[model samples]
Target: MSVLSDLLDADWARLCLLSGGGLRPRLWRHVLSPRFAPVLLIRTAQCLHAANWPRLAKLPALVNFVLFGIEVPPRMHIGPGLVLMHTQGTVLGAATIGANVTLYHQVTLGAKDIDFTYTMSMRPIVEDGVVIGSGAKVLGGVTLGQGCVVGANSVVLNDVPVNYVAVGIPAKNLPPEAERSHEPTIDQSITM
Candidate 1:
């Protein structure tokens, strides 16, 4: 799908999420909210980039970076249903992110090296339905599995399995039983 279409779909998904999946709100409601400014701006940047207008894309991108303090490169691949909850200090630095990914405040998808000489595999890959908690840092070439959850203030330097939760300073994955019983610290709707 086109970037604009993806953005619209994502916006609708978010609206559904916000409405508790009861009623799908009108498009105007999604477009006019100040809370969705960061998302709209980011989606616009992605659209501009995909249209081969990197020079033009940087304009809105810079605006988003400044206004929301979030930096998501237009080149990065993000599927639809992307939700950035509490946009403050959120940085989508990953090489690839799948659909329905929810990110909270102060989340950093960062590189472990200072330069690109380390190879293209140095970037993070976040799969579908992943929820990265606030103040979490996912560094290096780790692949976070689908439905994985990173706890707040955790630092993930390695891969995490599907449907699991990683927590603590260095970030250790919890057992399957533990994950089933534990509820993440964010809205449950985005887990779709």
Candidate 2:
């Protein structure tokens, strides 16, 4: 899907809230809104980068840095439907991020330290539906598995198993539950 469509699809919950649970929102109106401005800048940068205009891509990213204090480098590969909640002082220098990822303000997804020579390989890969809490720092080349929930201010340096909740200064996964009630199940043979 196009970035706009993917973004809107991912941000359905926010759209519903913005429209007071009305029908789906119009593209230009919502994406351009201040609340979604950070995401917009990221998208713009990505588009510019994809279009082989790295120099031009820096413009929106620069604006994003100045206006939002958010630093999501154009090199970062992010899936659609990002949710940047309370997204001030957020830094996304990760290698890859999956769909429907939600990030709170002050979250850092980057190298372990000030590695000037570090490449994208040094950054973390956050998978789909992961919720990173405020002030969380997920560093290193670890893969944060899909559907994981990271607690606030946690520092993660290792791979977190899928669907587990990791918390603390150096994050550690909690034991898995017997069954997850929050997640939906699917069966192709079943009918609604």
Candidate 3:
């Protein structure tokens, strides 16, 4: 799909996410909201960058960084339905972020080391349906599995399995919900 279509899809997805919380969201209102400005600018920057206009792309990117405190590299590949819950201090240096990913404030996804050279192998690859909590740092070349949740203030170094929850300082995966079944209750009574 074209960049405009992707942007529209992302806006709609964000609207749905907001409406899920019981607040009716109007498309026009959402489009004009300051909260959505970063997404718009970032998408615009991406569009410009994809068109081989790096110099022009930097304009929107610079605005986003200055105003929202969100640093998104123009070269970063973000799929549709991307939602930045709160953009303050959020830096995205991922190789590729899949569709329907939500990232909260103060989240950082980048290289583990101080490599100024933006190499794909040095960044994280976030899959679809992932929700990274606020203050989370996912560094290095690890892949965050689809449908996984990374807890707030956690640092993920290793790969998290699909549909698993990763929490704590050095994040560790919790067993998948399917494997966490409750034991059956047994009735031990003598019937007459």
- Prediction 1 TM-score vs. true: 0.84
Candidate maximizing lDDT: 3
All candidates: CA RMSD (Å): 7.3, 8.3, 4.5
lDDT of each: 0.82, 0.81, 0.87
TM-scores for all candidates: the values are 0.84, 0.82, 0.87
Model 3, residue 187: distance off in Å is 22
Off by over 4 Å in 3: 21-29, 181-192
lDDT tens string, model 3, 29-134? 6666666778888888888999999999999999999999999998888888788888999999999999888889999999999868799999999999999999
Query: How many residue pairs clash in each candidate at the backbone level?
Result: 0, 0, 0
After the best TM-score superposition of candidate 2, give how far the Cα of residue 131 lies from its true spot, in angstroms.
0.4
Candidate 1 at 47: error in angstroms? 1.2
Q: Residue by residue across 31-81, what tens digits does model 1's lDDT show?
A: 655557777887888888888998898988899888889988877878887
Better of 1 and 3 by lDDT: 3
